[model samples]
Target: MKKIIFFHLLNDYSGSPKVLLQVIEAVAKKGFEAELYVGGGAEGGFLSSAPCVQKRYFYKRFENKYLTLLSYSLSQLILFIKLLRYRHASAIFYVNTLLPFGAALAGRVLGIQVIYHIHETSIRPRPLKLFLRWMVERCSSENIFVSHFLAKAESFTNIESRVIYNSIPQNMVSSGANHVYPYASGNKFNVLMICSLKAYKGVNEFVRIADLLSGQQDIEFNLVLGASDSEVDDFFSSVTLPDNLTIISRCKDVIPYYQRASVLLSLSKPEEWVETFGLTILEALSFGVPCIVPPVGGPVELVSEDKEGYLIDSNRVEDIAAKLAFLHKNPEVCFRLSEAARVKSLSFSVDNFESDVIEVFNGV
Candidate 1:
């Protein structure tokens, strides 16, 4: 059997890792032996024990700065040596992120086919972006982008790449009962913002929006941070949270919160970083919750104006507040949007993603 070596940057169960897991499963189902090489560690939290992962290897991830050159050199040497052993095994190198410079280099040295799956945009430092562009254009056999937005933004010259949107697993979507508006149940209209507690994710803006709507007694704001308690405490200590706001520290399962939410906020600011694709928006939409996304990045592609959700100026807290208020006051409009959101999410299903990935692998 042919072997497929997958290289991923992180061990955590984030968007890219989740997509990698699904790809591994798809590759295995197609009778290819799939092995995962994590840059962090072999025991990658939940991903280490994922089914169909025939083997796992660990290597140090490359850092962008010049100071880590020595360590980067050593890591690349080790990775190259390891990959050399698989040279005669019909192995193909599949890099999951743009930062796996060493893996792409090793694949090139070994004369192996390299497929780079790009999950990020907004790469910083001109030199670094230039280096990545060179690598992808010169070394990679195929380039797969997670969104059309990312493909359009790519700076590579004369390079053609495939645009495959990220997908939501079917089982993750809540089924059976229709989503009920929070106000319909005589409960406070709940607005949710779920993402990493990074500044780019607009956590501060979420807090500001919560403060903006604090005067309303019948509305509640919930911010679910994918951060540790210490991080949450440190961040919250510097900001003042309104009484109407609640902060939840990292949840393994966010389906319950999604079920309870009347509106989902993807208020990521453009200056910080343009989202390559917003998985959270689709997750919320799958649960029949309308999303309010900024007019920047890939999230805008997922939301239709006044259809699935509204695109607002995420920089202005009042604009976001007004949109939330509109939803709260107009249940009939919210219901229509919620139903449309769910219907839209059906196009980005895991089955479609798997099929696309398998076809890519076969062509390669």
Candidate 2:
């Protein structure tokens, strides 16, 4: 069996790490010897629970943006040197995201195959983003994108690329499977939005929607963020929270939030940060919970208009509030959408994801 060397810049409670964790688990189950060279060593994120893979830390994450960038460049330099030491035909480099350019460069120089699993398009500093794209174009043997939207947007003329949509891990799916339809909550309509504490992720927009519908006592809003309590407080210090809205932070378990959700929300700003495959939306859908995603981006691909959920602009506070109000008032419509969402989620299954990944590995 060929060995797999996974390189990820940061290991936090984010989408990229979660997807890489799934990929590593799938590859390991197939009896491949795997090792992960990640920065910050999981930080109690999803990768902390990774199975059958040796974990190694190379750098630490910083709170300051400029310091983080400096640390990132340093990590890559260190990764380039480490990858050089492990250069062999039997070992392939699996670089997660566009940030780990050092491992990709090393693989390119050593004539070893490198696969780039790209997840985002919002890389800042136009020149730096262009440089990373150039690296991918020249160094990567193949590329894996999380959505059709991303694949088309970041297409290279010569590189072989594949779109493998992220799925709910089998363990997570099983845990939510036994839950009764519309699990928990008697008469209250629970609206939930789970995302990182980033402004471009539409955190403010979600808050605005909650405020707009504050008068509706039966409807409650929940924002489950992946940041610490202090960080959450600092972010919302200037803003006033609505009485009907509840803010939760650093929640290790989001399944309970999904179980109690009447409708999940994906309010990512398309212009600033297009959501390349909404994993949380899929998780909520698996639990028979419908969603209200943004009008554009990869999330639109997951949901059908007026079926599982509606596609509305997150910036339109009145429109979003109206949709939530309608769902809260109409039980039959909400139940119908929930059933559709559950059925739609079945298409993106772990079996399908693993099979596609195995094919990619074999081809390499």
Candidate with top TM-score is: 2
- TM-score of each candidate? 0.90, 0.96
lDDT of 1: 0.78
Cα error, residue 333 of model 1, in Å, equals 1.4
Local error of candidate 1 at 122, Å? 1.3
Candidate 1 local lDDT, 83-195, one digit each (tens):
77766668889988887777888888778888899988767666777787788877788889988888888746655579888886555743412555443334778899888
- What lDDT does candidate 1 reach at residue 332? 90
In TM-score terms, candidate 2 sits at 0.96
CA shift of 314, model 2, Å: 0.9
Report backbone clashes per prediction.
Answer: 0, 0
Which residues of candidate 1, in runs, are more than 4 Å off? 41-46, 54-78, 155-160, 174-186
- Candidate 2 backbone collisions, by pair: none
